[model samples]
Target: MPGLRIGALELSTPIFIAPMVGITDRPFRAFAREMGVGLTCTEMTAAAALVRAPEGVAARLLDLGPEEVPVAAQLVGNDPQVMADAAQICVELGADLVDVNLGCPVPKVVRLGSGAALAREISRTAAVLEAMVRAVDVPVTAKMRTGWDYQSINAPELSRALEDVGVAAVTVHGRTRCQKYTGWADWDEIARVKEAVRQIPVLGSGDVRDTALIEARIRAGAVDGVVVARGMLGDWNFLEQTVSQLRWGEPGPTPDFADRLRLAKRHWDAMVVHHGEQHGVRLSRKFVVWAIKGCDGAARLRARVADLFTQADLDELYQDILHAGEGPTGWHRPNFTSGEG
Candidate 1:
């Protein structure tokens, strides 16, 4: 795959890690960068919240570690001026690119006329993105769902409008707002959006789990790139494997049980350092669960995860997880979906 350029920002590859709320924090992004993801985005931040409290919000949601550069800071809101101001804040805080989130399907966001709801209001969404483009010298991009519902699949029209307003690029999640990740993501609709836009790069999202699915979306949708979201949940090596397969036509080195254990430990340590032990240990439970998802006796390990409150708790369970992994080792896709991004 060729590199992707958004405005003056050049990415090494077209593959990007989707900006998932609560899941794509600084530690997670750092690990993704090490794993060879082309671009990493900050988890979605509310424009109004970021503008009202830049320091607090940025610290909580937009904090980028040293390893995380060439990163896109994603903002979500319905207000044009607030979004513009937030874009400026993101740029000030070392964001290489600023992205508007128009694909979030959560009811609160839609109720505020943001996220997927804004995609239905093309002119309004265009106005918001246009202001952001004018506000930041860095690339201004948008990620949106196909439309409000199947009855109104208007990503093509919306993409055209965004491009006309000087938006750098657009990513289309193939599912509609109504779908909310229930069924399959329609790559055909993503291809239609690609056909509609003349200038900016068009990327596709949803249902991109493994190498085969990634290749399928690129070929079938004929998009400029693909965003790996839920697919990267437990499998951080997904991007590395993808780069190897796409660039070299060979699968990259797969992690054995020991390799996984080492990386998982590193990930937990980083999380604790970044988030502090109390919160980090609490937050790391889900990641531990994801890492051990398909291993033997995964249920028992997961049950132990719930009681994890400190490093000692995790240390005690680590041996058990490694012992369980002695039986078999292989990649296991995460069977889940996220409503964010």
Candidate 2:
């Protein structure tokens, strides 16, 4: 497979890990990169927050390790100039690309006239993206839904406008804001966006759980690439498997229970080092839950995760789980319904 070139930055594979809020943090991104993900992104950072508090929590959202380079910094906002300034800040902080968030369907974000709300007005969204393009030297991209609702499907038109305004690539999550994560993604709509754009790459997202799905999309010429979102929750090695399958027609090795436990331990340690013990332990619980999904005694393990307050507590649990010698012999498939983007 040829590398995906967005502007001057080239990715070894076309498979991208979505910029999921709260899940794609610095530690998690670094881990995904090590797992052979073609490209990674920071969690969606609010442009206003970045502008309002560069030294605050919003700035911390831009945190990236050297190992996670060539990552896109995703920004969410409606103000063109503020979004522009935020894009500049992202570039200054070493983002290889800046992606505008136009697909997030969360009520809080939509209420602010950002996220999917931007897609409601193509011209305004284009103006915001144009300012961002002019503000940074890196490639500017946008991730948008099909439209506000089934009655207002407009990704094809919106994608064209974004392309005209210097957006390098567009990722279409094949659902309208109204559908949220329910129902099947409209790949037909995604294909329409691909047809609407004349030059830039068009990637597809939503419900992409396995390599075969990616192969089907790419082979059908509906999308230039696939963005793995919730599918990557517990299965950190998903991207690696995807790359192998796409390139070699082989799904590659699946990690067993012991392997997963070890990986989970490594992830826990990294989270601790990145966020400190107190916050890190709490932040890492969800990841632990994801990792243990489909494993024997998973429910019991999940119940214990809530009480984990210290490294020693996690360590004790890890040993017990390891000694229990339970879980799938093959790769664990994450239960996406239990989580959100």
Candidate 3:
């Protein structure tokens, strides 16, 4: 695993934490960066929103610690001028790179002709990327699905178009827009895109469930790097595990109950500090589920955590999980390939 260079920034490894809406908030990005992810991105911020209220959006989404540098700001929208302006705002607000979210499959975004919807029209996509690249001094990149649908796979041609417009790199999520993460990501299609773009780096996204899958994808010569999305949920050490395997041929060890609990507590504290207790508790509900997923008595724990509204509530739940034995050994993990994250 060699370092990945996107224009001026150099990543220590090719393992990137994909910009996940609601999930990749500042606290999460900080945690992943501290755990040694190569690159971290902000959750997809709307281009029009940022242009209209740069200060407010920056305060809300662009906030980052000094240690979270080399982070990319991901923006999604259909208007070229608005996208360009948003990219410049992100650059001004300390983004090391600016990434366009052209692969998101959410119906709301697609309905607005953003995200995967952009893939339906090559000319519009090219124009948007060109505008963004020209607007920002920092590296400008795009993340896209293979195409709008299986019937119209155009990643190879799209890759060429993006490269021609001076994109620093592109990430290809192997499924079509129609697939919306239902099936396995096609590494072969990713390889085709890699081959099509001779100059810039091509990254693979989707189905990055474990270190084995990450290694297999890279070893197959399909992508220079990978964007770990849902696979990273509840596992801060996931990137470190992949990097360890790449460097030492061992993924170290699976986090035991105590380690998981400690990390979960840290995440909880950060959320509370970043957003007050009321909202933080609400935001942490899903995180609590992810933290305790596959653990012994997880169902009961989730039920209890759902009604939690304060730090005391969280403490009691943590105590309960600790009292239980380490979760079922060798627990099963779903192959979450959905790019909805």
Candidate 4:
């Protein structure tokens, strides 16, 4: 696969992380960068918040360390002017790129006629994209689903419209909003969307969990890149593993048991540093499970880890779990439901 050049930025490898809600927060992104990922994007922000008041949650979206370059800020809204103004604020805050999200399947966003709902109104979606591009001097890109439903899988047409208006890159998630993560992803459909555009990078995103799936998608030949989402949740070594495979066509060294524990502690410390003692400890509960997941003795830690209220408690629980015995041969993960906020 060839590298993509979006303006002054040149990504040597095209494997990128998909922007997930709580899963792609600041601490998680910092860990991902340590594992050698190329680019990282913040969670979606409300354009209205950025425009009306640039403090609190909006300011949090612009939080970046000096080393975190090429961080793209994603915006979700139906108003072109609001989105345009938000993009300018992000640029001033030092965002390397701006992305418009038309791919989220969550009902809250869709009910508001934003996110995937934009797919239903193609002209309005295009107008928003055109307006945003003109307002920001930085490169603007898009992340879109196949369409609103099976009856209208117009991603190929929409993809072309985005490219024609000077979108720097395009990422197409193969499932329609109606599909809602069910059934197999339409890889061939993504191929068609890539064919519809020229001079812009096209990326395939959906159901990619490992090297085998990534290799098949790359061989599909339409996409210029791949975005791994759920795959990274429990797999901290994702970037290192995928990059090694892409570069040397071989596997990277797996972390030993102790190394996984150390990584988990590092993540816990960062969460505490950012969110403070009480709140950070609660938020990091699930992350502890994900960090130690798949390791030899990880399962023992799941049930009791969430009870901890401080870093010391977390450390003690890790020791207890490590002492519990052989972990499950395989791990069980929960399914995402609409009930979640």
Candidate 5:
């Protein structure tokens, strides 16, 4: 597949990471960049919080190192002005791009008529996209589901509308809010959305678990790009493998047992540096379980991962994981409920 361009920015490769709530945090993004991810998005930040408590939200969520450049900041909310204000703030804080979340299926977010709810109201979605575009000089993007539900599929129409208002790119997740993460993604609908957009890039996100899936999607012209979400959780080498496959017609080298452990250690250290000792250690637990996936004796190691409370505990657990034999013959894919926001 060819490279992708979103406004003035150009991506040499089309593989990108989704803005997952608990998974795509700062440390993970930085680590992803090191591992060769083309672009990374911060987990969704509430537009209301960015407007009402910019300082706190910035301190807690939007902190970015210089190395994390070319990263997009994703904001979630229904209000046009508020979302715009938050987009501006994200730009001020060094975001290379700002993305609006119109695909989050979480009940709490949908209750406020935001996320996938916005897709149901095209006028409101247009207003929100317009506000965000006008609010910042950087590129503005929107991530949406096919529609609120299968009965109301509307991504093609919505993509055209977003393009009309200067959205730099559109990412369509093949499932609707009502469907949540169940069932196969409708690549046909994703292709329809791509066909609807005239200029801006239209990326696809849903069940992209490996390089072959990515290759198939791009080869089918289903989308201009692919977003890897759950696929990245436990597998640090996934991006490298996908990128190599896309660019050279071959997947990248796989990390052996020691290499995997070393990568996990670096990730743990990064989490601590970015989030601090107590909190970072706690956050590392899920990632640890993910990293240990497919390794031998992982089942035994996972049961003790929850007992981790400090950096030392994490170190000891890694030791235990290392001491345990290599994991299952084929690694298990990390499983998480998929949706944006």
Candidate 6:
């Protein structure tokens, strides 16, 4: 797993953290990078919303480090002009690449002909892709699905079309818009899309929660890389660990349970510093649940932590989680596949 190359930047691995609204903000993005994710994108922001200053959302999503090169800013909307304008803003703000969102299955987004809704209108989708790619000198990428539904599994054709317009890469989430994350993703379709295109990396974007699924996708033969979405929310280590496995051909030695917990705490502390205590503790709550996933009593801890708003309260709960167990057992994890949505 040598770092992935997107135009001028070479990522250390193919494991990029997919942007999730209200989820993949700056602390989360930086945490993933520290843990060795190859690339990280901000949560999807509306192009229309950017008509005003995007600074509020921008502050939450932006990060730049020498090692975290090729940072991508993902934008979502229906209007070709707004998408182009917003994409230009992202590029000017130091984005190494700009990713257009086409696979988000959220109801609010799809209803607006943004996200996966764009999957239904090939002409408009083509227009947005071509305009965005041409609007900025930076490489343009797109994240999309199999189609709007089973009847519309048009990714292969769409992939070809997007490539014709010069999209540097395409990520295919196996489920269709109608599926709404309810069924298994059509990975074979990802392979189809990859074959349909000639000059870009095609990434498999669904059901890749761990190394096993990753190897399976690579074996299927269409993907140049894999994207981790929900699997990364609670565990920042996913990317770093995945990279070691891909690079060394072996799972690296596991870190101690306490080590994992400290990493979580550092992330929490960083959040508190970055966003202040109230919001930090609130945001940190979800991560605590993810960090303590493998342990017994995690549910109870999550319930308790939800009400906590102060630093001391967090400290108390964190200590309780640490002491309740005889020792750290690392994170609890799930087989979260986009198809499972």
Q: Candidate 6 on 144-216: residue-level lDDT in tens?
A: 9899888889998888888888888888888888877666778888888988898788888875677756855
Tell how far residue 96 is off in model 5, in angstroms: 0.9
TM-score of each: 0.95, 0.95, 0.95, 0.91, 0.95, 0.90
C-alpha lDDT of residue 36 in model 2: 75
Candidate 2 local distance difference test against the native:
0.85
Question: Could you give candidate 2's per-residue lDDT for residues 1-341 as a string of tens digits?
Answer: 67688888889888889988888888888888887777899988888889887465555768865666779999999999999999988887778999989988888888988899878999999999999999899999999999999999999999999999999999998888888888888999999999999999999998888798788788788999988898877777677789887787777898777886798789888998899999999998888877766667777877999999999998988887777666565446665542222
Q: Per-candidate RMSD vs. true structure? A: 1.8, 1.9, 1.8, 2.4, 1.6, 2.9
Candidate 5 lDDT over 261-297, as tens digits, reads: 7887899988987788989988888888887887787
Candidate 6 overall lDDT versus native: 0.76
Each model's backbone clash number? 0, 0, 0, 0, 5, 7
Candidate 3: tens digits of C-alpha lDDT, residues 1-341? 67788878889888888888888888888788877778999999998888888586665666755667889999999899999998988887888899998888899899989999887888899999999989888999999989888899998898899899999999998988898878788888999999999779899987787787677767777788899887877776777798777666678998876786788779887987888899888898878777777778877887898688998898888788778646756334444554462
lDDT of 4 at 268: 80
- 255-278 in candidate 4: lDDT tens per residue? 655665666677888888888988
Lowest lDDT sum, 10 consecutive residues, model 6, at 59-68
Worst 10 residues of 5 by lDDT: 332-341
lDDT against the true structure, per candidate, is: 0.84, 0.85, 0.83, 0.76, 0.85, 0.76
- As a TM-score, model 3 comes out at 0.95
